[model samples]
Target: MTNARIAALAALGVGALVLAALGAPPLVVAALVAVAGALEVVGQLGPIALRSTLRTPDAVSRAAAAAAALAALVTTGVTAATVCAGAAAVVALGVVWLEGLVGYAWREATRVVERLPGYTAPHSLGARQQVITAGWYLAVVLATLTADGRSGELVLGLAALVVALGTAAAFVLVTRAAIRAKATVTARIAQALRSYDAPVMVYLSGPEGTEYQLGVWLRTLERLSVRLVVVVRETALARVVAGMTSLPVVSAPAMADLEGLQVETFRVALYVNNGAKNGHNVRYRELTHVQLLHGDSDKPSSYNPVTAMFDKIFVAGQAGIDRYAAHGVEIPADKFVVVGRPQVADIAAAAPGAPLRTVLYAPTWTGFNQDNDFGSLDPTGPAIVRALLARGWTVVFRPHPYSLDDARSLAAIEEIHQLLEADAAASGHEHVFGDRASSTMSIVDCFNLSDALVSDVSSVPADYLYSAKPFVITQVDDGPSDAFLDEFPLARASYVARLKEPGSLEAALDALEHDASSSEREAMRSYYLGDFPRDEYADVFGRAVEALVASRCPAPAAPVPGTPGGAR
Candidate 1:
């Protein structure tokens, strides 16, 4: 809980104690106690408006709130009020504790059972508990307000005790049944996996929020002829990926659990990133591990030394092969396979001469560390967008999802969004920002809608090359120089927007309007994205998978029964 919230609860408890010492009116005491009870109920039930402000209360917060409520109840100096408040407090604590236990049980159940398609967890038990707890608190508060005398107070106390005990027993029974249901579902999933036979397995293991890396390859993998499965190291990721694709997803968090699955039938395993958890599956020597990086770029991640572990590395083009050599990361030349980027095949080429040109300012994110921080959003993003708007061009501001991780980058993105939104309203220019730019329309969709591009030293610019349109690539630290072009040869076909130069961005935009680099971009297209026919780009990846499968020698025929140690 936040410190402010804790301080508020502490103040309320102190106020209750002071009021009781001074002998505050019974109605005032009941009001204070009722407020405390209401806050607790709202925290537990969490209505939509309060969802962001009220989190699941911790044991410390719960106990503090209960103490305050008890102190207020005693302020009335009535036995019935005190007894009723105490009973409500116990029920509230029990409900919260049981809710937590149920959530943990559900998670454990999901881990044991591979998630089946269309399976949703039962949430009604927790909902029922919240409703009962809310009603019990309301009843106690009403009994305190409407009770006429001592006889009436005694009746209210007895009724409160009965309801609290009954609710506790009912919760216990419901929790036990939910746990048993989880175990049964797990058994069913295990029984179904025993006869499974998928030859290709996509192994993805990373922290929770980086699911986008795995999402990039799902459509392409689905297009392959071979039967495929997705395996993840985190249970949360398994549930998420299962919903994103129709393919079977299994969560095998431990090495032993992974080995227990039907992996002997898998001839090849594909990986999207070089996360540490990948070591769990890489240890298996019999399977041919292939690295299909999430994006093809000049960034250091493209040539990571850890990539050497894979038997084969599938890249978009020759640029991918040469990137490793330039960075002095040694891997055999035969290990590189140039399967063209099938993702960009659907991106429409530019149709120049529009009256109002739209520039897609898609900056990348600051990478894992300084060495990989190639994004320009924090440095030149606002200036770039301002310049484009100044020139009467519509702006489609699509910042990288990971860029939001940095406060400075996010602030800059928001500033640019406000500038565009205000300009859009006044000048009648349709500008895209927020979810429309980041979520509703994809990066590829943004590419098709724009005439030119201004982005950082990430995959966005590399992928935008398929559009055969003019684009400006920003320099990270210094202004454009021979060193920058040498480091990112892809920039040879782009207008360089030097970070330090006063008018370098405007100059690039001016050059782009005239289509000065049109011929150069056509040549670099083949160099960066391979020379595959546009119509057949997706087929290249599919055929490559077939070749990899055919290249593996067939498993030796099962040995004949009872002759020479089971050898045929």
Candidate 2:
């Protein structure tokens, strides 16, 4: 075990020894450790479900284990000291849960307010989960603290006990059912995957919500027939990939799915994004690993230190190559294969629609972590939209998908929507291209629909480089002291402005006025997205995968049907 785990165990042992020295029964000590262990398992679960934590079949299995453990802890009766420890631990667990979940609740209640899209998952736990953990913890505490030898107190305690027990039972039953249903889907997906032995496999073993990234990868990997398996983990992430990309998606419930499958069965296992389960899947020694990231950008994640874990890191351009080199990560130059933006080619050009000059205002969501806090939705987003509208240009606001994760981003989106709605009413033209579910559009579709783009530092702008269109980049106002992520490399070539005040607006207007960025676009495009002749990325991507396959397990040279010379 790591030092932290060892430390935690040592601390727990010291605590047990103290209780024993205080004349506590051995049973109490045992119960204390057991309850603490249960809480540890649940607490380590943090906000993200513990089972899905592995991103494997074990996620469901762990869910079942957690629920069962909670039930046993509640139903079992021991000495008052034992009950007190359990209750204190429950209360402590609630506090721990709150420790993780408080931010989620705070964000949900307060709403994340940013001039631009800026966010990360609740630093601790979600509001809903906080409430659940609190309720259970309080119930157990009330039951234990109020317990007495008197019949009246006993009766009241028993009633509290009932509520706690009922709650635990409900969680267990619900978790079991959910696990079973998930297993059914996973088994079906596994069975489907078992039939395919495609040499190139595009595997998505991450959460379901991230399937959008896989959709783009699927489009990038189009033309070549390959298996796009969504390995089942905590979220049925493969469902989205299956729906989006009609490719056969297999759910690997266990290692059994990969049983007997060797390098002969599958040559390359390309992961869309590195996930926790990805580390588990990588253990399969025979499969050649190729890391195909969602999009190529200058974000720290664009060239994570972990990318070195894979055999090959398929990059978008020299930018991706230089990004790792600059970070001083150990991935060699040879493993970095440049594959231009293939997904951009699939995004059909948007037709000019009811507008004088249309601009796609697509800002990225506040990042999930502070390392990539490059969203500008709070401070500059509204002003930028208004400025564009004032200039008689229809603004299409396409906020990042995760923009609605908190209140602040949602409010900003709502404000932008209101601006668009008001503009549409007066101008007789649709200002918001993405609002309702039907009207909700993809980044590529928005790229096609707009004349230009004004986005934050993200893949949206990076991919827009493919259109050779003029776009503006918005810088964040306040962030960490030492996060040096060049999210938008084009800022050096194109318009780069800050969201501190109305600077984003000024820069955007300048871009709209000048709009003539063919030279800049071509140069920056070549810089980020290498020179793809005629803009055909499918051939480039295909050739790269073919090379990977050839390197790992090349096709056997066709034996001259009779003899080498005779066939000729």
Over 4 Å off in model 1, which ranges?
Answer: 1-84, 87-104, 111-187, 194-196, 252-262, 352-356, 550-568
Computed on alpha carbons, the lDDT of every model, listed in order, comes to 0.72, 0.58
Candidate 2, 1-568: lDDT as tens digits? 2225534544553454455455454444444444534454444333233221222232222222223223334444565433543443354433333333322222222211111112222233233443444345444434433422234544545554555555555444433443344334323333333455456666666643577667667655656744433344322354345456555544443454444233355778888887777776677767788898887887778878988888888887888898777778768787888888777775554342323388888787777788777788875678778888888887777777777665798888788888888889999887655554214666677777777788777877778877766777776764431242253456765576656644556865686567656677778787787787755665788888877777767557877767865464
Candidate 2 lands at a TM-score of 0.63
Tens digits of per-residue lDDT for model 1 on 18-62?
564565554554565466555655544421111111244333343
Regions of candidate 2 where Cα sits further than 4 Å from its true position: 1-195, 226-228, 253-264, 347-356, 435-440, 478-488, 501-504, 554-568
lDDT of 2: 0.58
Give the clashing pairs for model 1.
none
List TM-scores for all candidates, in order.
0.78, 0.63
